[model samples]
Target chain A: MRSSLILCTATRFLLPIILMFSFFILLRGHNEPGGGFIGGLVAASAFALYAISHGVTYAQQLLKVNPINLIASGLIIALSSGLFAVFNGSNFMQGYWSEFKFPVIGKIGTPLIFDIGVYFLVLGIALLIIFSLAEEEEEIQ
Target chain B: MNLIVLPVILPLLFAVIMLFAWKYISLQRILNLVGSLILLIVSVLLFTTVLSDGVQSLHLGNWKAPFGIVFAADILSSVMVLISSIIAFTTALYSFSTIDNERESFGYYPLLNTLIMGINGAFLTGDVFNLYVWFEVMLISSFVLLVLGGTRNQLEGGIKYFTLNLISSAFFLAAVGLLYGLTGTLNMADLSEKIKLAGDNGLITVISIFFLISFGIKSAVFPLYFWLPSSYHTPPSPVSAIFAGLLTKVGVYSLIRMFTLVFTVNSEFLTNIILIVAVFTMVTGVFGAASQNEIRKILSFHIISQIGYMIMGLGLYSVLGIAGAVFYLIHHIIVKTNLFFIGGLIQKLQGTYELKKLGGLYKVYPIIGLLFLIPALSLAGIPPLSGFWAKFLIVKAGLELQEILVVVISLFVSLLTLFSMTKIWNEVFWKPAPKDNPEISFKHFTLSKKIMIFSPIVFLAILTVIIGFSVEEVFQIANQSANELLNPINYINKVLGRF
Candidate 1:
């Protein structure tokens, strides 16, 4: 559980940058290769790095929300995305698009929302497993 | 709008909500109860709709068949869904009394709903790959449910259950990959027609056997049934009841569905293999049950034995045989689940599940004895009960098919089942209490707790009696479902709109 000062200092700068990049990946996932699953992994790895630099306790405090809630919310979002189509008299999981398109990300749709849900879920699951393992490691040490 | 999706989605929705409300034990309980009740109503609605309108299929995202995932509810699918919902509702009610507060607060309701959702999805989906997805959903939730308490016994059982099921899933996935590679379609209806056109018997048979092995493990047939008795007795009573009732049946349902719809080319060969497997499954299961002294363990073996009867009907490959299978399936789900629930109640009241350690229930609580007798006799295929009609149908079908050997074995198995049930009755209910033991009284339980537990058992026993008495009505439905299964054209036409 030893932490180097340089690593801790470096993590302070790296954390937000990595999170922003993960969001970027998720936002562009509809058209690009980077989607929620990969983005969530990236986000989770950034937190894992932070936990290594700081400690599991500090990293959990930084998370603010419980990982299980994040997972639950993500599932709700994903389910509702499909449900949107059903409410619109379309088939389940059918994507509906708006005419106004953003420059970086394409037109807003259910698929992107669905991807975001995946992002949260993957992030939550990854973090939960990592944190639990790290805590176990600490206990053993 | 396709109501077919409701039975699947409603549980998912309920699971998600319960997940969010995980901390509120009372709220979670009420929500689960309400959710399962609503699911029962929705399944009934779906059943009636299918009955009046014929087979129903919903293409997700409005994609055409052979391309998009479809949820189809034929008579068979609706019947299975309806029965599963009934089990879901009863289990939810049963849990109120048996499940501890720790398990409740630890996400039991959500997991249970997810399992139901998976079961419904498996029954309703028209796509093979989607069926795999549903199976995973069901398995994942079930894995957690099996090991939820994290007890030594549970973990031990969970590891074996997990390993074997993972292997089964791998086989299932491999089969799907090969089938898709061969036929270029994942839609089951599409696969039916395309497989016929593929016209290569040798490879198709190979793929079919791969599927048979995969599903055989899940359904707990013959040699593959070792995991069932080892793991099922480890879980809590309600969990074991649901597992005994619905989980293996999903595999049996898949076996019946695939063998009937998609694997007709090698009927003679497959029939021989299936009949052999069926006979062995029956004999071995009953023998295993007879040797068990524990209540749940005995019931677990009985579940395996009864599965053989269903498979036998399928091997018969006639309308009556299939009808018999369907009837046996519906009857078994009710009887097996009730038996487990009664087992749980016995454990609760007497504080032991070991036959050698328990006795005198009939002397103290004749009501309990009566309640247990209904399902016990039903499970033993006693006359004028639901199981008798079920056994009669299958035995008659076998006779008509001139499958005298299977019929004889099946009847012998029935006798063995009776012997075991009577053994339970004699040991647990009839015999006097041991010298060191005192008589346990139901007066100790609160009225509400007693009501919560007994109501489901009473309700299911009544259902068994109703189905037993109204055999004509139930058989007609089973026959109709059997006819639909026999002719895949109706399913294909409904799903693919080939007309």
Candidate 2:
């Protein structure tokens, strides 16, 4: 499959915006319908789009790390977020909100950390699938 | 710090650590070994705590029961977790020698821990949806494990296993959705109470059948068991051993839990159906085993047959019967896994799994033959072995219930199991090697590899012998679990904190 110059130029412009929007969705997920899963998907689509416009190798170079490691780190982060409650003398995954509030993100808490973990994990998984399939297609061609 | 969560969390933790340490094979191996040992220790602690404390529960996010997800462990859950950890540990040891570097580097250790996490989560979760999630975790990891080597046979078998299990999961999800719609709760204890109040026995019965089909496919009962023989023998031996030991048993575990806890209202009819399924599963499984020419295939079929006895116990529906089922479950896991381990060892030594191509194992290695005899005899329900006690309990419970037909069928199946075992022994051990069979020896393995493989088989064989010799103590544990199962009121109270 040959990449179009127009498509490549559009991806170059749209990638950062899509990634930023995914983070927005992830942050808003605490109160709204969106969460780590959707946000991660959005972020993954950004990279996926870049892979489609450019190439698998270019996308991998851009990502700079293996997606599997991303998944592993995401899992650790998510689990540690849950562990915060255990450290606080409560059951696993108990939510404990702090009194301080941030300007843009509002309240920074374990739930946000959990969502970040999910975001990384979802992004990793989606990218892994996309990259593998794309590379396989490249091979077949 | 909640003890209940450790069984699930520790595996996830170890899996992650191993994932990051993937490039270093030695590090992964050490991590896998240490993780299994740690899981074993934690499960033992969880088991002891549950035994002494009656019932332990942890409500996630501090969400009280009937609302938030809860992880609960009574005697049954704790015992299953403990036994599963033992298998995980031994399978880890077995894998050290048996699994090749290709598979190990292909994320085998992480996947194994992930599978254990899923199994433990299924055993411990108090919420139905949570159980479904755990099942998915198990299935995903198993799917990868099944096809990790990417051999043609592995891929073929993996597809069958994957498709069937996916359908089963769909059914389970449908049942969960329907139940939640009908009763507005997913917690097992809450569902029990709400199911009693809902008074919609007809729909509930329909949901129960959906569950029966779902879990039935999983446990390999009767018509649904075709997947077991086709795919189980295709994976590597350690993989097969773990799968044989734990996967179907998780289904059986879910069956016992759901039927006892939430679906008890319509059990009279359901149990009658279970009894018929159990008998057919036994006869067909043994017959399948007898017809098989290979080692793992025979053992695979026998897994189905042995699952029959556990279902039979549930069908009996008394404290003694359920206890019998529990004992059979524990006994079957140890014996079946050991048999598969021995099968692997046989392949290692003789370079063939085909009984027709193999022979003279007994003459060459008497100790290996003795090791094989212990599990083989126990599996055949010979006296002074664990399987005998397990069978005795189920048969005794059936007699008390006057279910003479199942009892007779069970005994006949036992004879057939013996026949299958002896067929293996005669071909693989007793008879001389056929002409043109390549000569092979156990010394082909390095010393540490030999110890790695043999120690786990020996450990499990010893466990079988211990359970056999100390039937009273094991039975006492099973009986206690049975009583708790029979009386879910205590469980309900403990989880909901009504007391």
Candidate 3:
């Protein structure tokens, strides 16, 4: 879908802010309502909007890495987070937290890591399917 | 971290690793082989642990029983896992020769491992909702595996398979919702106690029917089995083989577990209905096989028929009956998968699955003919084979129950099963090759490929013969498992940690 010049410019301006907000959602997911699934979906919508205003090829170039790779890596991260508990002599998926606080993201834990993994997974899979469909449409045209 | 959860965890971890290693085909194959071997070892250990220590339960995320998701391994669950791992290992070996580089590179290993994980989870899960989740996991992976080749026939079959399964899943979910509403619990052990307390209600009977229909569609019994024959013959041979071996059996297992464990109020009406369905499923399956000339399609119909025997055992609702069902289940999975592997081999040699277009295997490949005979005769309930023992127990149970008519129909179905098996034999092996392509042989294939093809079939065939010869020991275990199913007190107590 080719948008008007104003709409395209507006999408470009809104993309960064939307992406940042999605990250915020992912970070606050453990204590708040917003989580990895919703955050990833929101992030994916920003890229989808960019693809609509510009072209799929431009969006592809922006992605830098294949979506399949992102998905695989995301799953690996999530699975490893679960395994980390086993290494610590606990059950699978047992969560552990640290008191150390980062500058922006406060106390870190395995659950948060798992949420981040889910964030990448949902974003990668959604973009992968959508971009492929868009590319197919372009080919038909 | 518990031993009981390893069967589910190991395969899942392998699948994730396989996803990343998808680019390197040979490496993926090696990893799959090693991973399946590990799964086999783990499941065998689980079997031994359950044998010695009774039921093993793990509450995931460290939560207590009724509220938390529980993974429990009883004798029945462990036995199923053991058989599943064996099939997974053998199929992984067979896939090396049969699966092409194209399919292998497309994350076939990952999907296969994921499917195994799902099967293991389904067997071990103590929570009904968790069982549904595992079924979805199994279903999605199986869907991809079914349509992996992207052939037109496969896509058509995949759609049919997916649609029917989705409807069944909907039924299952609704039943779960209703059951939860009634009893306020999803744990199988807890539900067992609560359902008895809430008992004798018509609504419970309705819920039982809902579960029957849901699991019935899954197991492909009688009238609800059209999607099975239509779709099962469409996937690649190894894919179909695994589907033949394990998928419907999972449905049967769930049926057995739910009926025997949770819905313990057995009315005469329900028993009669189940008996009728069992007999019809047998007759229709065999008759359907009799009409088909294509090898896999014929075998596919037979899968439905054999499911009847298992259900008959359940309907009998006796110690011998459940044991018979358990034995039939173990024997059938190995035999059915071996038959599909042989079919794939025949297809490789003759370039067709249609019996009329293929022949002369007895003369050119006598060894292959013998291998085929083992599973074929065994499937037909010939004496001293595994099927004979399975059929004998069920028939004996029927007679003991005084259901002579059902027994008569079952015996007739056995005869028809023999007829179909003989038809495949006479056409595919005894007859002369078609005039167009006279010489049908696997002579040109490399030695490793030949070994890869033959090893799984031989190993499984040997297992069948071993089970046949060691019937006493095997039956003892089956009897014990049956006793456990008949009396769920031990299973419930262990899962709830009441002991």
In the range A43-130, model 1's lDDT, one tens digit per residue, is 9999999999989999999999888888989899998899998888888888888899788676999898899899999999999999
Q: State candidate 3's DockQ.
A: 0.56
lDDT of 3 by residue, B371-447 (tens): 98888989999989999999999999999999899999999999999998989898899999989868686776899
lDDT of 3 at B243: 96
Give the 10-residue window scoring lowest on summed lDDT in candidate 1 chain B. B435-444
CAPRI band for model 3 = medium
lDDT of 1 by residue, B1-499 (tens): 5588999889988988887787888999999999999999999999999889899888888888989998899999999999999999999999999998888888999999999999999999999999999999999999999999899999999999999999999999999999989989989998888998988568899899999999999999998989999999998899999999999999999999999999998799999999999999999999999999999999999999999999999999999999999999999999999999999999988888899989988888889999999999998999899999999999999999899999999999999999999999999989998766665877667889899999999999999999999999999999999999998788999899677
lDDT ranking from best candidate downward: 2, 1, 3
* TM-score against truth, every candidate: 0.98, 0.97, 0.96
Q: What lDDT does the true structure give each of the candidates? A: 0.93, 0.94, 0.91
Docking class of 1: medium
Q: Write the per-residue lDDT of candidate 2 for residues A1-141, one digit (tens) a residue.
A: 678999999999999999999999999998988989999999999999999999999999999999989999999999999999998899899887778988987878899899999999999999989999999999999
DockQ of each: 0.71, 0.76, 0.56
Q: Give the poorly placed runs of model 3, Cα more than 4 Å off.
A: A1-12, A99-107
